[model samples]
Target: MPERVVPGRPDGLITLGAADALWVDLTAGSAVPTAFGAFTRSPARARAGYVLLGGRAVTTVRASGGRWSVSVGEVRRAAAELNAVGTDPQDLVRIGPFHGAPWQEADEETVLCWRRRIAGGLWEPGRPQRAARRDLDRPYHLAGIDWRQMLVERTRDGTQRTWWLPRAVVRLLDAAEHAEAQWLQASQTHQAGAAVTGPPSHPRRAARDAGGRQATDPEGPAASLRPYNGELKGQLYSVLSRKPGTSRGVAGWACAVCRTAPAAVLDHCHEHGYVRAPVCQSCNTLERPDHLYSNDIRVANRYTRLFHTDTDDWLRHWHRCPGCRARTTLPLPHLAAWTAHTACRSLRPTHRAPRGRTPCGVLRVSWTGSQNTPRSCLLTVTVDCCPSGEHRLLAQVPYREAVERFRVWLAETAPAVAAAAGPDRLDGLPTEPRPVVADTSGEGLALF
Candidate 1:
């Protein structure tokens, strides 16, 4: 064994350093789990090995205002040591930067090629040095190895998308925060549900205070164990225990995406245990802003067709998250997937050209229970509104289109109202909505 000495800190947990072992304690918000009740030391070590060797850490969790604050600073020390490249063969792995590799420069290729290549995503054909950024998209979870991942990509269709996430995401996420985000993401997956890698026998929530309970504790009650956070535990059961997103006992209010309230987020820590955060259901449960395949590693190209084999394909994904390196399955179908549904749901993520006056009178109204139907109307009426909280709404009212349609329909169906209407009354209303592609294929079916 490599010098089994604990660099002792106040936290009693010793870190075995390169030179020698020293007794040192950690600071208040140290990333190292002191005594996490949810996991065995063996798995944790394997995980830790993978993380430490990465040369980075999630310094900021999503809830921590997306800031990377918690690091042992060992990363800097590690960098300095590894910066020399070929220092000590025993402690250092040669991360041969593939300054020259035959990577795809085409806009059409995706990371899936690495899945079928002779070198695999990790290795080179002839004593490959370190892998290139365009080299990996699969979940290469082993520690102490050189791995490459892409953070963005340009699709062949002349559209650009991000497969890898931002670096700010790192150093910002600790294990628990990352785990919760992943857990919340796994729940909202579409046709090919997301997968959880290296599941603990009975994963439990992280304990916040001394009063928090632990099932794994020798003296604690294990039979009736529940998640550490009470509200989230209740909500997780409500949304996940039964069919996903269905109306269950908890009103699916806990279903972060569907419910209007910021829902509880779930994850695990190295030493602390599972962590659940109170976040917008949409951000937490619906479209995973965190789950992405970057420009270099085109994950979408890989899984578009991986499940035709006799083997249980869905159960065998190996793509690791660039954020926490948490192993995850295919991108979950968002509760509001399908281009039309997605666009209708979040105007923030959607981009549409301004509507122009069209021959067909179209009224795209997003209505809520509180609002009554217009006293009189005409033309084409389309509404893609879903019900939510009583009032506290964050929706975008179709400012221009709705107004134009109202007036046009009034002119045809209720000309009296059109004549009575004043320009001041519809100041924000445009003269017309731009003509859209006759193709409704990209749009959502009209919803109530």
Candidate 2:
């Protein structure tokens, strides 16, 4: 039988230029479990036999804000590397110079294509070099390499999307693929003998609880004991656990907003804890100011409608005022403006009307009750009016009792409101301004 392609070593950071050894990715190109070779190259002479893929030398310019930008050549070098791994490598000379200014600006086609290469919205520095280890029983190898290398394709719009992989990784990945095929064939033909891959006994089944149930320790050694699946659920789980707005999630296959660029990162509502959709960096960055600072409810709603899979809850609640029958926006939870909408106090003054309008209305809800007094929750509704003391008291009652009464009031008042209050009609509302993001990089900007 051919030599079994065993795991190289316990994976950790190893200096590439130092000692020579085999660095094998047990899962091939699937997940981030590439292991540093456990054993050094057998002989010093063997070092000469292996080829090393050299990285492009990157030159960085740090702006006054400490943001980094790379030369135009670096972008071309990345494009070249990505094309080299594709089925049809396009000519680097044929690809035109980037159109945007400062070399960091994101366009629809380029940003979308750029997001596919990056795991999150932002290009993580040194991510292309590091492979976090994932435990697997069988030493399975698949075709192609990991996210370290990417393939490039030309879009119909004449823009390019590409990801780069090193030649060294490509060679090792190809070798590991061959090794796996050989091992599988050997195990199939010789069933009577020991299998070529996988441990003698599964590590996850090794430990048991007092009740005779299988014990699991995801934070311990058992974290790495599970079987490998192609879906990358392990990495996704890690990403979901992080704080909101962290550009640590996987890249989207397509941007949900523009639908033109590939989504570069997972966009989320920091205030509402709503995990939105994978979107391009431009779309993701554009969402923040609109949701937080913009006074025009329609503009903010437009973004929410596009990026969020479901906008019914947002629309039905804060999007339209029940009293004034006008569309309005709400502030984040921590902002002082949010107090007007929550019944934490006996009574609070309503928010000043949005710029250039009268006090539209205020709809406040309060669920304040201890475990011993669950029924103490209350809902208070009020609308600010032009004359002081002329304010209308819509409702004040137990939270359970208030819902039915409020619905009755809303039903009666719905017909009299003007037809101009439709949420979808955004012809004359204020437009969101284009925001300039800080350009930061390590080696260089990956999305350029």
Candidate 3:
């Protein structure tokens, strides 16, 4: 006789089997019993060595003569786990422990035979002969079980036991069993209802047939026309009927802006309360002016430029500076002028004129001849800090080196000066000076 390997605990075994072969044995006494009212209940023990049924441990027996009983606590836990895996435990039929010798020869044939018998309950007689084999292969393949790793252990007591199966294999088997049970129940229901059938009638169709009417049949368009109070509908019908070429069936008119989408709304001036033209819903909602002046063509043109075209054109033409590559909201010409003017003004004050008076910063750049020539082109940047102050010259440098010096000052020197002065001192600094274009055309130079 093979060694009788009693699985886990012998006392309270809950055997789950199919076709007289034990498949899963849940140990009912491994966990301590909790007292409820007069009865004591034992929870299902989750042993790590065995496969998990729906993520809960499934203890199996290798030997015969173990007490087979299903406890309420064990059933509940199994049911909960099964429900989590989308299988209803109510659909499965619980079978008892059947007498069988322990598996002594652990080979492919033995393991395949055990699996076939256990899963054979899901196979119907009408199925192909190879259907059981396919079903057995499905779970094994899906679970990724390694047959090479499976070992048969023999204990000192001469009992033989099979190795632990994978958890995925157990879940797949449980799911297949559930599906088979549901199919059987559905087949039974169909057979029982076979005597009472013609084609079934829908409740809605039956109701409609009985009353000989539909909700929209008598007054769909006519009911909708009533809300317009007859006058507006009459006016629309008369106008559309008169202009047959313009009305063009139900296909809506084109949008004025994009000229592609069908116009689905009446665009109108909110101030004048008059319909302008039919426009697409998108154009009507998005392109409407925030506030409109009188409905003149000039006003309309101005609105188009200010609201739509000008913004897009400005953004398209904008580019970062070549020297500093800094982004500014100001236009290119304005930014170039501002940059050169700001750099010249940051020079140290040479002479103090008066206290409590706004100081004027000037940048005089000579464009023509040498650095010390008398007949060179003079470009003066007079930054007036006060409203009532006369222009005074501050700093002078050659035009060729002014921009380079400004760029260097901006990159290396300005940050340290601004940081040391802090935000409060900087705030007291004069506002940005506007560029003053002088009459330098006399010297053959244009102030940009």
Q: Which regions of candidate 2 deviate over 4 angstroms?
A: 1-276, 279-374, 384-389, 397-448
Q: Candidate 3 on 181-216: residue-level lDDT in tens?
A: 222333345445553774432211111343322111
Tell me the tens digit of each residue's lDDT in model 1 across 159-205: 32212222221211111222333332332442132135433321222
> What is each predicted model's overall lDDT from 0 to 1?
0.24, 0.29, 0.28
TM-score of 2: 0.22
Q: Which ranking of candidates, highest lDDT first?
A: 2, 3, 1
Candidate 3: pairs in clash: 3-158, 3-159, 25-59
How well is each residue in 302-330 modelled by candidate 2, as lDDT tens digits? 33232234333332323232211222222
Q: Candidate 1: which stretches are off by over 4 Å?
A: 1-139, 142-159, 164-277, 280-448
Candidate 1 vs 2: which has more lDDT: 2
Error of 2 at 127 (Å): 34
Give the best candidate by TM-score: 2
